[model samples]
Target: MKARNKRLILVGSGVALLVAAVALVLSAFQQNLVFFHTPSEVAAGKAPTGKTFRIGGMVEEGSIAREADGLTVRFAITDTAKIIPVTYRGTLPDLFKEGKGAVVQGRLEGGVFRATEVLAKHDENYMPPEAAHAVEQAQKAAQTVSQ
Candidate 1:
């Protein structure tokens, strides 16, 4: 085989391998990706039905109910206009509290969210930007609907 022809074949093979590697990495990343949605989005049926995802909003007041088991707790997450019921069966973050902002990652089950992980704000007035934006948008939508 000619030397130039051999070099061309090697370069093409290297490019093909690089492309395959990048595709593999992207597919793996996509499988692990979890999207974030607000309570209003979940209530509107916009969230994935059974896939793992994240929901962020304010924990509703007077809606927290701890089960007999020390680790099980149910509460409502609200984005000002809508609420989603969430159940967590693990130790909650110390910052987790009603009327505070929280982000929970989990899947939806029978209209309720089963949270596998919970993230609460680090301090007072430190709401996550996405949660705050969602709440503001929900409130605006509610006002528009009322008018």
Candidate 2:
């Protein structure tokens, strides 16, 4: 084979290997990634079924329920468009309260979100961007429904 042909073959193999490496890395990252979703999206079946994800929204008022044990708490997340029930069995953050913005990371099962982690906004005026966006989206949806 000519020298130029040999060089081309080597370069082609390197490019193929690089592409494969990148694809493999991306696949692994995707599996570990927790995507953000709003209650409205979950209600619309846009959220994954079993895969873990982050959901951000306002904690529905008058929806928090504590189990007899006190550790297991259940509440509903709302984006104004829809509500998603969430259950968490752990000490909640001090900021966690009804009618506040929160982000929960967990999986959905049987229409209930089983949260492994929960984060609440710290102050009255402070809210995560994800939570803010979700709230805005939900408000828009609510307006559309009312129209």
- Give the best candidate by lDDT: 1
Query: In candidate 1, how many Å is residue 53 off?
Result: 1.5
Which residue window of length 10 is worst by lDDT in model 2?
A: 133-142
Candidate 2 lDDT for residue 48: 92
Q: What lDDT does the true structure give each of the candidates?
A: 0.95, 0.92
TM-score of each: 0.89, 0.80
Cα-based lDDT at residue 4, candidate 1: 100
* Cα lDDT over the full model 1: 0.95
Model 1 RMSD in angstroms: 1.7
Model 1 Cα lDDT, one tens digit per residue, 1-147: 999999999999999999999999999999999999999889889999879999999999998899998999999999999989999999999999999999999999999999999999999999889999999999998999999
lDDT of 2 by residue, 1-147 (tens): 999999999999999999999999999998899999989889889999889999999999999999999799999998877899999999999999999999999999999999999999988988779878888977886788899
Clashing pairs in 1: none
**For this target, which candidate reaches the highest TM-score against the unseen true structure?**
1
Please list the residue runs of candidate 2 whose C-alpha ends up more than 4 Å from where it truly belongs after superposition: 1-28
